[model samples]
Target: MKVSCSVVVFALVFHFFLVTGSRSPPPSDSVIIIGAGMSGIMAAKTLEEAGYKDYIILEADSRIGGRVHKGQVDGNTVEMGANWLFSGGPKSSPAHEIAKKIKLRTLYSDYGNLSSNIYKQGGGLYEKHVVESAFKVADARQEFGTNLSKILSSKKGGDDDISILGSQRLFKQVPKGPLDLAVDYFYNDFEEAEPTRISSLKNTFPRQLMEDFGEDSYFVADPRGFETVVHYIANQFLSHNNNKITDPRLQLKKTVRKINQSKNKVIITTEDGSVYHANYVIVTVSVGVLQSDLIGFVPRLPHLENELPGENMIFVTVTDEESRRIEQQSEKKTKAEIMQQPFGRIYFAGEHTNSTYLGYVDGAYFSGTFRSPSDSLYPLLGRAT
Candidate 1:
């Protein structure tokens, strides 16, 4: 499918507004960004930079940094969500720019170490030959699949209802044996969800981008925590505006029960009988939360059509002393990385999303955001089921 240029424009405009703080609250329009995760905060910052001051962030949880949760364990800090800085190239990766702009320290990840312990189920532990053979095979398969996608796109109308796997089989030759398994592993590493559910064409885009513009790098701040970064960003925003960052714009502990949206206004009702209204509302809650139908919408969302169901991204942190010791020793080798699986609007973004640096402080910094088409304030008017 063709990418939407309007979404790209919106993202760019939003980013600009965040960085420049040029937006002012509209006289009749107000915005409410749900969740305080990296994406939500980024969205809020974008609005703030754009001079839009009449916006509030509503967080379901008591704390900010939705998926980028962090805490201390045995004197070492652990991240519950997003970590790693895929790359720190002076240009391209926005995360890198944000890190530098916010004065956050980062470190380069060591993927070439070739010292990973192979965990086998029955064959026991063996010194696998660097698995370079598998990687090579996977690479070739990926290239072939990419070329095949192009060919399919070029072909005249054949069948619009063909499955993605069917298209791959029609256009590209599949790699066999270890190569196929390796390709599967590589794809898994990138997607973080499931391989069978992803489209070969769609998967290749981010993989290609990461190969070119991304770096497998992560950061370890002096204090070794992800909250520092969040605190830094919040502080900077507040400092620039001379406003108190602790202002309760977010209605924490007040779960949103229903949303009522119209062409002119959007109203949100909490389970506690409280109501909030705004012109624009950015729902930053997790796909898991959305799928649970915890929050009801009035008119319902149509962009959700053909969207994949929620593939919950779990974050498990092993913060024992022994684990921490092992972590430090493998610090250079262990870095936050992302699994490149696609599951539609339910984008995965967390530190554990990667394997090498599962629970590192940097992992919490690596999670990303996603937006849906019908995500505007026009879907919350009807009654709940």
Candidate 2:
């Protein structure tokens, strides 16, 4: 059945000393941040750090924490999305620092003894040794992107850094043998996307950049509930004086129907017909939402109307019984028993992304900063039309 509810609209405008007389100034030359998800919150925090306090965050959901949803399931807290911090060292990880500052705990995964029970396609369960041997064969048979390597190593250069078509070509170069297929599955598993569909340039360039930064393979260490991290960040914005930061910003249960923007101000219309305005607006809605036109833009956002990144989402779930079974197995086999399950777009983050500690709290924390944007503002405006 279709259900509808009226959401209470609230605006908390954080006023600075620059504003003279007006209680609610006519959309001052301040910034308005849309969505309170990780990107949005980080954007707001970045602005605050940069000494900009006049901005307001508009959240369509009834609560903050966009993809970082967490709750109790079978007596254990589980994250619905965004679960682990990858390579979150002090110098490179903002999410990790935030967690430390807020006193959040983390659980580490032991990958050294990782052992997975293999369920073959033909119904029989293979021995762990057999599966490991197969995985190694698959790894060896995997074809590297020579074409991409050539382009990256070239002088004249190509149109875009990477192309979907180029990635598709590289995938085709690898033979469709069992070993090749296994390798493809493994890489695709981590990417959460089909090999042919993923961005070859984007993936390669990022790895190259990381290498330049002295980072080797990806690392997943601390895992914690992502929701806790979100709440911790949100608490910072709230003032200790009256427990108020702005005038009560953050609207829940309200879906943005359309956005009308001009150089002077941005007017956001909710699904319920109510309208809200701000001086400058930062759009942090998901690429999926944008692709579906769930939120419309008036005078239309030319640059953001049609184009979006080629990223997919993955979701995962684990029960207490399952966790126990793995622990027991780990003890008996003297091998780390962990479950690595991958789903689409809706990732189950917070201590569950790794095989060593699937569905643990740290998974969500690790995932929060995985694809974190460099500058929140740049991501908002960087979408191509």
Candidate 3:
């Protein structure tokens, strides 16, 4: 599903003025970007590069990186969210390019090695032939699920709400015994984060990581943490001191409480009782947050709507009817929401908004920057293809 990043603006437009928590008047801008994650920061950088600086980024967390955060584990810096950068996609991942430009350390991880290390419940390693046979059966079942999904998705109107389990049963590849079940869990449950019984075959089947980005997945080994790339991107547009963004354009720890949209503009109220006015608003919060009641909308958002393999740190993904439901309208929603359209003056973006590559950092990058004209970002942001 393709969507364009359009105008976003808020609450009943009027000349009435009221006392706010801040002694100073609330600031207004051409755009108010919610969330300082990959998508939000990219949007800001795009605007900044275009010489359009009338924008402010409000991030709820004290830090700038959202899910792409790093934590100290025993003295070693470790990624808490996204770690692997799939550089070999049909279109090279922009994140991969940025990592190279910034010289972020990375190590190639062979996920196939994971199978060789698998052990039995008692701790003895499984025989090579046994492991191979188990995976072969699992692979066949996945192929069955993929083919079945294509058949269902090709239906006249759209897809039928069917779980992958339904197709698996017909394929007669039911897992038997502990080893078989373990392989099943590895291929199905671990990959999709949902049991086949509940996973929508049409939406979740057909793992595409290898198909799109090749077999190699590079693990970020940067001492600064995987999120250092985001800091590097931010440094491009915002002034920074000692790796910390010191620019006034980026505001941290500002939790937006409500967004009121009017015909003329948008009024955003934060938890601190501070109000902000903007002609456009780009929301890049996670799907989990949007599905939650964390931020209220004067006019509730409109309705709308996968998993893949390869050392994937992201357990959830959202697309198509599934995308619209996860994004605009909530339907058998998961932790991830895929695509979203412009709601009034608000434009939605994030990894979830990328249908083809949802759940990846590169997805969020492209969603914020390189969409084609048919499905591009704001005119001010421009398009690469």
Task: Report, for all candidates in order, the number of backbone clashes.
Answer: 43, 38, 21
**RMSD in angstroms, candidate 2?**
16.7
lDDT per residue (tens digit) for residues 18-47 in model 2: 232133423235665667776566556655
The estimated TM-scores of all candidates read 0.63, 0.60, 0.77
Candidate 3 lDDT by residue in tens digits, 1-385: 1111111111111111111112233323378889999888987886565445678999999998798889998999988888887756575667788888888899987768656767898889888788888888888988988888878756654436466778878898778788888888777676556676766665555545445655467889888887888888898889999988999989999999899999878899999999999887888887667656699988876441121222122234456886676565433223222232346677766766664555677667755663522132333223211
Q: Cα lDDT for residue 85, model 1?
A: 57
Worst-scoring 10-residue span by lDDT in model 2: 1-10
The candidate with the higher lDDT, 2 or 3, is: 3
Q: Which scores higher on TM-score, 1 or 3?
A: 3
Top model by lDDT, which number?
3
Q: Is candidate 2 or candidate 3 better by TM-score?
A: 3
Candidate 1 residue lDDT tens string, 293-381: 78887765433332344422223245689568645653322211112222212223333232212222232232222222112211221
Candidate 3's C-alpha runs over 4 A off are 1-29, 302-341, 370-385
Pick by lDDT: 1 or 2, better one = 1
> Which model, 1 or 3, shows the larger lDDT?
3
